[model samples]
Target chain A: MHILLVEDDLQLGSAIQRALERLAYTVTWLRDGQSAIAGLADGSADLVLLDLGLPRRDGLEVLREARRQKVATPVIVMTARDSVEARVSGLDAGADDYLVKPFHLDELAARIRSVTRRHHGVAANRLEVGTISMDLATAEVSYRGERLELTRREFALLQALMERAGHIVRREALENSIYGLDTVVGRGALEVLMHSLRRKLGADAVQTVRGFGYMMPREPA
Target chain B: MHILLVEDDLQLGSAIQRALERLAYTVTWLRDGQSAIAGLADGSADLVLLDLGLPRRDGLEVLREARRQKVATPVIVMTARDSVEARVSGLDAGADDYLVKPFHLDELAARIRSVTRRHHGVAANRLEVGTISMDLATAEVSYRGERLELTRREFALLQALMERAGHIVRREALENSIYGLDTVVGRGALEVLMHSLRRKLGADAVQTVRGFGYMMPREPA
Candidate 1:
């Protein structure tokens, strides 16, 4: 899923970005609250990882402004403020989950899964479109109940497509969600990645829309 | 629903636009194929009413290019080209429904409804969200099974909001989908219309997101 990570700490942000990328998520890391507010208003990212302490503007102010502007993107607040009052304030400001700073990455991952599940109104970190089923928590994919092996890049690409299963995902959107904000990718990188994915899944698994992007059928071809 | 109408004939285009507006549909009327391709790619309109013969680019070419780009917006071809080969080619070029020229307006409206129903995979022209129900054909709206009386403007506005019941409909989107392309609306026009709707349905029927537009709950408030 596309995550807009708003954190000022370079070391913490870098660690979180790598951890999320390892988990097959594309990260757009911004270090200030002003930019976070603008990014959230764009309504492209599926989720937001917001830091309560931010530069230029306060994180709570950003959250309040976003909510007031009708941004329904789920947010998980990550901050050094571990006090009960801080937690309560974050929740009141419309945070989906609160993570105290210096926490384990594993806990952050769990929180991400739980938040996503709640958003999808599903019981677990599973997405089933037609014969394809994905266990996002474990990064496991199965076709018609048969286990399928996929490379990390392929898995990340498939996860993005699976999220919007039957709809057309524009090429730019795919690139933004699969690669980090600063990563420089070749022109043919996406097509090459798609080619390998199609070979493993099936030639008809992903349909290319010439100049636009790709679509995963509501039912398998 | 929003319809992108592409017809070069001034009389015909104006007639279709008026008919659609009378039915409470927001219409964006274009006069050529070049613009139609751009409109379809933008993906704003829910449906397109296309004419096959055009200047700059043929309607068939527009349809073919849009489909190639994965613009899955439903299109109903309204054209004088009624030969067997023409019909076959139109269907092959991704026209969802075809209508011969000089047809009745009622037929066009029916075609539009059928295309939308097919896209949504619904059996009838009805939308039910929570305790609210709307019959698009009859323009009838009810809350908790009781019929609610509404002005024409209010009904049109509510229809736009009901279409996206669970999500925040941006103010610009709502306006574009409810008013004709050339409409000049006052700043307070939407708010005034929304005020009456809220009064009839209940104070909490629609939630205002302050700076943003509005959201209707997935279920009754």
Candidate 2:
């Protein structure tokens, strides 16, 4: 998942950025609302973490403008204003979800997953294909009743495929989720990850859509 | 499909824009290389139709900058420069396809489809699922041996679904392809289109993947 984080506080922004990165999310941290708006307009990020109290332009205004422009990238409002009125206003302004300041990183991550899942119309964090099951919250994959170990990138790759199992997930989309947009990734990085993931899961667990991308078979053979 | 058209000539730009819109493509037209570069950086376009001769910055420079920034959006260069060397240089600069100006609009449209198909790793313009086949080049869909007529948006929606049969295509992705990113589409437009398509094809032709999107079964059920 790629997150465009609009937080002006240097310490908080850096900390959130690091935490999301650790959680395998590609984070693009911008300090103000203008840049966030521009980023959203250009479709640079898959999701947004907007802090309402922003410099140059208020984050709520940014969200409003994004919606006005019909930019459908989901936005999650993060602010110190914890009142129900504030939350309702943010939601009304087109924010998909809200996060109050002084929040735990774990809670923030959960909200991020929840909002993205809801946006994708997925009802839960657990994605399953046949005997293979994955818990998005814990980043755990289990095959038939046995737990399988996966590296961070491998888990991310699997999640991307499993999220839309039986569909060809584009190579670019997978790379964006695993390595971010600005990173110069090697051409074979995904292939390597897929090879490892397949070995651990099952030989027929993943299918290459040749030239397009990869897919997790809807019904494992 | 969304195309970022980078051309400086006002008459030519408008003509191409109108033609593409007529062909059901959502086009974002820019008149300079700098704006084109910014647009590409923000992932605003699905593909680029670029002119070599540009203002402020050379079109080649824009192409180079986009590649340097790790922007992998496919670009098709459209220019009056027809020399072998110029084509070679443009291809080296990461252009996916090339077209010389004073060309027929039909040929341009064909090349657009060809290039986008090649980029997606689709070897041909025809997509097939069981007895149903769609000729993207001619916009003709046939069920078994019977020909079926469809509206433009319906054709586009069916094409998107059939392109990756058996995979769940996200509703957002489908909407982006049908209505473009900036258009305010009605909520049930997709559902209505899918309903019409299913009626023509078969009740089991398309599967609703709940909130995520829709899919075409890998095998006819």
Candidate 3:
């Protein structure tokens, strides 16, 4: 999971960032709402954690503008104020959930999990592809109840491929999804990852697209 | 991430569920808007892939009702009807991004990444905490400008910690993020992953929370 954390307090921001990452979430940190808006325009976050007290733009205004521009990303508001009216206003402004200061990190993670679940319309935590079944929260991949050991890169690659099964993923995009944006990786890194994935997933699980990309055709039941 | 896939077509739903799993996203397949709404109300998904041609309730109507109920999960609309009117109406009625049928799985993945990025209000692909940095698109992690080599599980665990940075994550959640929800991992799985993570990350990089979980403290400049 990826999260956009918008807050001005350096301490809290660092704290929340660490907490979220430990749970395997990718986080993009922004010190103010304007930066948050700019990040939204760039289009990469899975969820937003917004603090109302910010420099340049207030969290609520950013929320309103994002909705106005038709950015339908989920937003969760964080603030020191816990008034019912504030909560109501935040929700009315399109914030997904609200968190007050001095809140529990567990609660925040739970809320985030709930919001993403609702956003994606997932009713359960397990996902299956062909003969392989993946438990989302546990990161386990199994075929016919037998487990396969996958390297982290292999697992991430598999996850990426599974997310788009039956459709081709361009080499560059696939690379981006696995390595992320800041690291400059080699051209052959994806191929290497794919090779490992293929070995673990069994032959014919993934198909190469020659110069285009790769695809995992839906398995015949 | 968990996804609620709301498509009336059983074949398509099953196929998509497979595809999404390959990408490592957990999916719960629902056949109509009513079930989708129920799933959302139950708050189980990380995001929603909603088909506008849903039975029981229209996709747009579901969206309106979700918003009315202050359900803030992000919704990505999918449809066979690729008309401008459909796209506009979907967005206007509260759907996030609209994907036309026959779209590539890679494109869907990209759209999911894009909307997820937008929703989070952060740059979509990078993970930064204190002096440490990791990029999801490029597969690199650095601390104090020095590159760090991490095993896949270590990298994932570190990425999770970096995402939430200062928060204390519970052991169960940490295990879920690393191993997933359905994999029946042994008691020492987390300890092994954490030990390897600390070894690669250098001494004092990650802190043990004793009974709670682990934490990645911010490094000084």
> Using DockQ as the measure, which candidate wins?
2
In candidate 2, what are the lDDT values of residues B40-71, reduced to their tens digit? Answer: 99897989999999999999999989988989
Tens-place lDDT per residue, model 2, A1-221, is 67888899999999999998777677878788756755565454779999999997898898987776566789989999889998999999999998998999999989988888888896768888899888878777899889998888888788778877866677877887777634656789889989998889877888775545776778986
List the candidate numbers ranked by TM-score, top first. 2, 1, 3
TM-score of chain B of each: 0.57, 0.58, 0.56
- Candidate topping lDDT: 1
Best TM-score goes to which candidate?
2
- Report the error of model 2 at residue B77, Å: 12
Error of 2 at A199 (Å): 2.2
- Per-residue C-alpha lDDT of model 3 across residues B55-142, encoded as one tens digit per residue: 7899889988986787878888888895756755666566667788866554576678777766665456677887788866545678
In candidate 1 the C-alpha lDDT for residue A211 amounts to 47
Q: Select the stronger candidate by TM-score from 1 and 2.
A: 2
Per lDDT, what order, best first? Answer: 1, 2, 3
Q: What TM-score would candidate 1 get against the native?
A: 0.50
Q: Is candidate 2 or candidate 3 better by lDDT?
A: 2
Clashes of each: 0, 2, 71
